[model samples]
Every structure is written in C-alpha cells, then in structure tokens.
Target: MDTSAAARASVCRLPRSVVTSVHTPVSPVGRHLVLMALCFPSASMCPKGCICQRDPHLHSLNVTCSQSRLKEIPPTLPVDAVLLRLDHNQIGAVPDQAFRGLRVVRELNLSYNAVETLGEGAFIGLEESLQVLDLSHNHITRVHRDVFARLKARVIVDDNPWHCDCALQQAISGMAHNHEAAARVLCRSSDLLDQDGRPFLAVEIDLCNLAKRTTDYAMLVTMFGWFAMVISYVVYYVRQNQEDARRHLEYLKSLPSKPKKPDEADDISTVV
Candidate 1:
C-alpha cells in the first residue's frame, strides 16, 4: 500500500471519542439550546395563552395559564405536564374527566376561578399522581360526596360559598388527608341562619340525622296523601251506592199498582 493510504488507515483506527474531540467544542449556550429542544414541548403543542416550561430538577413540564381569561379549560393540554396552574381565570365549572389526558399532573391550581360545582370524576386521571389541589376562593356551593373521596391529595377548599348540609359534610369528611382543611371549612349556608358562617366541623348539629328526619317527614306526608285519597274514594263509593238504592225505590213507587185480579174482585163483591 502507498504511504497516504496507510496514514488514512491509521486515522480511521482512532477511538470514536478522540475523533469527536478533534471537532470544535459546543458552547454552553448551544448545549442549553439542545437540552431545551429535547425536554420542552413544541410551541404548537402548548395551549394558547399559556406558558410551558420544563422543570430541570423534576424533568417534567410545568404549564401555567393563570389569569388568562379562560372561560373554560383548554381542550388540548400538554400530556407530559406535571404542574398546571389555571388560577385567576374565569372558568365556571369543572366537567367530568376534565383532566383525563393529563395523567402525570402532580399539582393543580384552580383557585380564584368561578367554579361553582365539581362534577363526579372531575379529577379522574389525577388520583394516583396528584399531590396538591388548590381550589380556594371560588364560588363553590355544593359538591358530591364521591367527588373528592378518591383523591388522596391535600385539598384546599376554603373561601367558598359551601352549603354546609349533609352532602357537604359527607364530602368534607371524605378527605382523609385534608383534615385540617376540612376543619376550616365554614358554612356559607345552612338550614338555620345561626349556623351560617361557622366552621362546618365545629357546628353542633348532626347533619345526617337532620337529613334522615327530613326524609322521614317527606315519607309521612306522602303516606298521608295516599291515605286521604283512599278515604275520599270510599266516601264517594258509599254515597254513590245510597243514591242508586234511592233511585230504584223511586222507580218502584212510580209504577202504578196492578189492579186486583178479576176473580178476586168478584169474590170480594159476592161476600159483601
């Protein structure tokens, strides 16, 4: 082989790292740009009117849509988002399975919104990964008992118009990991106005018993209505039968008495 061919063979035999190091070193900024490109979602994937950043420590996406004038949750959200902030928006309600696609979200902030009621399964996909759910300063009035029962996250539900009734009591009591927050829930509305504005847990009334009593009263009223209907029917039947008997007697009286048999009349005249 020629000398030039031999030199090329030697160069090819060098280790891969040595060959790569011979090229110009990439600057820190270039390395950062590469990392961001690899970690962060594309602009098209990010929801409109929102900011999405990658958490270097957590190695996950952090999506923030706070104060974005969102009337409702964006239909499409980055699926890899682990922290979502939607506070200070105009969202009115959380529909069922609202976050179904965001299975990895750990912290969800929905405070300062216009959320009035949480439907069942609103947080369906977050049950396993969700750590903190902030719902403070909303317009919530009532929630289903099963709405928060499955969530193990620390829920913040203060500063809302909660109707502290049996349903509310059950919903609050279902929060196993949020006892302190539950204890701080004040009654915005109650059966008795005196109990309003008081801590729901500190109230003296038994909501379950009250609910039971109310149901019992309703049942009693229904039963009495049925009884009255049956009694009225019996009275109407008796009056109708009496009227029918009187009409039959009047028909019998209207018929003229048959004249005595001719033989009987002749026998009577002969005896006279």
Candidate 2:
C-alpha cells in the first residue's frame, strides 16, 4: 500500500480514547477556563453598569453597583448574588418586592441614596438570608409599620430624615426585637422641636396613645356633627308636616255649608 494509505490505516487501529486525547489536548489555561465556567455559570449575567465577581473562597457572588446613578433597582439581577452594594445612587423609591428575586443576598447596602420611601414588600425575598441592611443617609421620612417588622437583619438607618410621629413610633416599636436597628434610629424632624436631633428610642412621649386620643376626639366630633344634622332634619320634617296639616284644616273651614233641605226645615217647624 502507498504511505498515505498505510498511515491512515495505522491511525484507525488506535483506541478511541487514545485518539481523542491525542487530538484534543487541553492546556492549563484552557482547563482553568473550563473550571471557571463550571463554577460560575451565571457570571456572564452581570447587570449593566454593575461589577460582578465570584468569591472563590466563599463560593458567593458579589454585585457592586454603587455610584452608578441608578434610578431604580436593576430588573435583572443574578439570583446567586450574596452581597449587593447599591449605595450612592439616586433610587428614589423602593416599590413592593423590589428585591424579590434576590433570595440569597445577605448584605445589602442602600445607603446614601435618595430613597424616600420603603414599600412594604421591598425586601420580601431577602427576609431569610439578609443579614445586614445599610439604609443610612437617605431621605426616608416615614415607613409603613410592617416594613421592617419581618426583617431580622442588622439594619443601619442613621442620618435619615425620619419624622418622629405616631406612625414612626409604631414602626419602631414593631421592630423592637431588632434592638440595634431601633436604637440607631434618630429623629431628624418632629412636631415638637425638643424631640428633633434626638434618638427615636430616647423620646419619652407616648405618641401612639396621643394619636389614639386624637383619633377618638375626631370620631366624637364627627359623630356629634352627624347627630346634630339628623336632629335638624327630623325637626324640619315635623314642622313641614304640621304646616301642611294646618293648611288642610283651613281649606275645609273655608268651604260653604250645604243649605238645609226645605223638607228638613218643615219637619223641624212641625216638631216645634
């Protein structure tokens, strides 16, 4: 046989595994790339304007979007992210379930943002895994009573424009178990000037009871007004009915009496 035909026959005689290994040799760099692909399958899904890196030692994904000028939370965040830093942005509000998809996020830094409100379900999915929540230096004036009730994270809410009112008092009281977070709360403004610039927990006034009393007084006033309106309507109705009855009696009196019959008159004279 010719040399080319002999070489092809010799190669075909080799074991399949040996032939495959010989043809596809993997370099160290290639092996490292393959290992990375296996370890971090979702690394390519990093959000725009954010930096995502995998922590090999901890086996976690860290997504950093700080100072990105983000108006709102990214819609598509990797589900494997454990640490999310979104501070120094312009996120005005966190609507319901804003981080609902980030179930594994443990540390969330939302400090130095323009977040004015925290919706009730903003951290719905992170309830179980979230460990630290940094909401310091925001424009948050008030929050719903149950907003921070379900979270067990060490929340940092210092330097916020918190309005020290009954609603805030109720919200803080609900999170009393989170003592660290509750203690860090400070009142940037309040109805009473003395309460301003003081820690929320330090204020001794019973705001909730005062609010209850105010509500009670408002209810009493409203009830009294409604009662007065009902009495006036009843009196007006009775007077109107009486006037109609008097007019009817006057009409009857003005009617001429029927003349007595002649036979009736003659009967009366005979009897006399």
Candidate 3:
C-alpha cells in the first residue's frame, strides 16, 4: 500500500471506545431545552392571530392569551397548563369536546368575549379537578341547567344577559341553592331590558315594564278573586245574623212577659 493510503487507513481505524467517549448522548436537560424552543419559537410567540405567553417558572404551568381574534379555541394548548387566561376573544361557544384532554386545568378566565350561546352539555367531560370558572362579560343569553350540572367549581357569571322568564326560572332557582354560586347577576342586553335604564331584579321589576305589568295583572286577578270570596262570606254571615236577630226578637214578642199577673193588670186598669 502507498504511504498516503496507509496513513488514512490508520486514522480511520481509531478505537470505537474513543469515538463513543467523544460523542456522548445528549443530556436530558439539553433535550428538554431543544423541545421547548421547538414548541415555542419565542418567549411571546403566539399564532399569527393570537396573543399568548408561557410562564417563566419551570415548576408552574401558567399561560396568558388574550385580545386575539380567535373565532374558536386553539387545539394544541399545553396539557400541563394549570392557570389559563383567554379573554377579549371572539369565541362564540365552547363545544362539548373543547376540554377533552386537558386534565390539569384549574383556573380558567373566559371574559370579555362574544360567547352568545353555550351549547347544552358543552362541558360534559372536563377534568374533575377544575375549579374557579370565570365567565364574566359576554353575550350569554341564558344558562342551561345542564351547564351547571356538569361543573363542581365556584362559578363567577356576572355581566351577562340573563333572561328571567319561565325558561330561566329553574336555572335561577337551582343557582339559589348552590353555595359556590355568585350573587351578582345582571342583564347586559338593552333589548332585553325595558325603557328604564335599571337592571332586571325584583326591586327593578318596572325595568321590564311589560313583564311587570303582566305579573301585576295576574296578581290583581288573584286578589280580586279572593276579595270577592271574602265579601260573599261576609254578606252571608251578616244576613244570617240579621235573620237570627229578627227571629229572636219575634220570639221575645211572642212570649207573654210574665203574663202581667191578673192582680197587676187590675191595678193598672183602676189607675187608668
């Protein structure tokens, strides 16, 4: 063999152990760093139309994404996220399958959105460990009974259009007994409120003037019926008492008043 080829062969024939020692396997910590960078390109890297940021704490799983024009929820959210903020978006509804794989989510903020209709059974199979649900500032027209039935957390549902009609009676009554429920419900829809600028509470009954009028009319009818019955009973009692007194007076007149004893009758005749 030529001297150059012999030298190249010797260089290529280095001990396998020496090569292995020089090229050790990647450390777990380094692998994790690479994964994070791949998962999130930047510290505040969100989707083109979304605004979001991951938590800096390695032990904490917190993310805040707000003010995005997201028409729906993002699918690939971090599964380990515990505190999530999704505010001021255009999320119209939470489909039943929205939180399918999110097992560790605890506090969720869904405020200042356009959520008009939350579908029935929307939160069917969410993580049982969930707590502190915030649905403040939205276009929710009504609360379905099933919606509350599926949740076991402290619900904050302030500033939504709660139509207090027969459709909401059951839901409102049920909410009354839930200790974890909040007490600040108000109507945010002008169309649902009456001409007055007041909210739709019992004290502000006249705010929904039409509904108030209808309720007053019903109460008036019931009161009139009761008053008529009372009057009829009183008239009957008075007439019966008057008739009894008349009969008693006639009987008194019929009875001989000790019959004016014969001797007393004769004395009265002589004096006359």
Candidate 4:
C-alpha cells in the first residue's frame, strides 16, 4: 500500500458536500441585482455624448441624446425612463420593437434625424403610455397609415418633404376627422403651400390637387381638339374653292370657241 500517495490524494480531495458549499449556486437576489444593472443603467451607464437628468419642467426622468450623431439607440436605457430625446442624429430607420424596453416612456423626442423608413409597428409598444412624440425635421416624406394609429399624443411632423400623392390623400383626409390628432399632426412639408407657416392642415389640398391636374389635362386636350378641327375646316374650305375654280375653268375650255364675225374671218384668212 503506497501510504504516501494515499495521504497525498486524501489531502488534495474534499467531500462532495464540502466542495458544493465552497461553490454555491447564484441566489435569486443576485440575479435580480444583475437584471437591475442591465435594466436601470445609472449615471455610469449614460454616455458623455448625451445628457440624462430630471427636469422640473417635465417632472420626469429626461434623457436627451440629441445631436450626438448616434446611428443607433442608446444601449441599456433605464426601463423607468420617461422623456427620451434623440433628435438630430444620423439614425436612418426605427426598427420594429425597438422601444419595447422603454415601458414607462411618456414623451419620446426623435426629431431631426435622417429617418427614411419607420418600421411597421415600430412604436406600437409605447401606444398606451406615450404622451408626446416629436418627429419633426426629418427626411421622412411619408409615414405608414398605421404608424400613428395607437399613439394619442402631441405629434409634430413638420419640415418634411411630403410627396402629397394618391396614397397620402386618404390618410391625410382621415386625420382631419380626429381634431385632436389632426391638430397634433403638424405637417409642415413644403408640399403644403400654406404661406402662413402654421402647421399646415390642408390634406384637402393633396386630395384636390390630383383632381385639379386631371381636369386641367382634360381641358388642354379639348382645346387642342378644337384648334385642330378649326384648322381642318379652314383647309377643307379653301381646297374646295380651288377645286370649284379649276372645274369652272375646265368647263369653259370644253365649250366651243365663240364664232368670229365674217369680216374677222376674212381678215384672218387673208393674214393666213
């Protein structure tokens, strides 16, 4: 029996229960703390490029990441964040379910970005809790019909280049019926030619412009048709007169020459 080797092995090894005690499983509270860290990022988590503070004017947790040129949403934003301002960034699109983690967000400000496409149901999760949504000064020309369906807030959509086409006509007209929603729809697209510069509410113009263009086209066609018809009639009348003169001359030629008098005939024969 190698007593030295046995003693060494016994010293190196411990009971299974003793080893388990040494390395215990993570407790529920520890897990909760880790989740808290992930969910509620404190001052350390906020970026130096942005601001996270409480405003007495808003009376909520305000996070302003405007003009930071950030291309994506801030990571690990506090779940209790109330007012989030992410304006003047280079963000191109709002992915679907992007703000689901912002459960208590009330006023979301995303103005002045290069947003081209807002994903379907992008802001659906914030439907009930959202209070004010500012999407002004972006490159977005048009929004999906249902993008603002669930949002009941002050929506600012100014300074965009709306196309004012057939598809936008119906939706803009429908927005008028809901005056609260309509008033909130501050569509300041240059497509809206209201000189007053107040939030343009002339969805009717978008609808009517199409009809107006169509009627103008029809009028132009009718004028052209009338001009062509008049020219054709004038040409026909002149040619008919020319044909009548030619026929009259031919008829006079077909008739026999007038007979000369006796003296005239005698003179003509003498000359010949």
Model 4 spans > 4 angstroms off? 1-48, 54-59, 170-200, 203-272
User: How much is the lDDT of residue 152 in candidate 3?
Assistant: 67
Once fitted onto the true fold, the runs of candidate 1 whose alpha carbons sit more than 4 angstroms away are 1-37, 266-272
What is the full ranking by TM-score, best candidate first? 1, 2, 3, 4
TM-score each candidate: 0.80, 0.76, 0.52, 0.51
Q: Model 2: how far is 106 from its true place, Å? A: 3.0
- lDDT rank order: 1, 2, 4, 3
Candidate with the larger lDDT of 1 and 4: 1
RMSD of each: 8.1, 8.8, 15.5, 13.0
In TM-score terms, candidate 2 sits at 0.76
Residue-level lDDT of model 3, residues 1-272, one tens digit each, is 23443343344443444334332265645444444554454434234554345554444466676876777777666666667778888889877667666677788888898887776666555538678778888888776656766576667777887655534444544555454443466554433436223333442333345567878999999999999999999999999999999999999999976656899989999999
lDDT for each of the candidates? 0.83, 0.83, 0.63, 0.67
Give the best candidate by TM-score. Answer: 1
Error of 1 at 217 (Å): 2.2
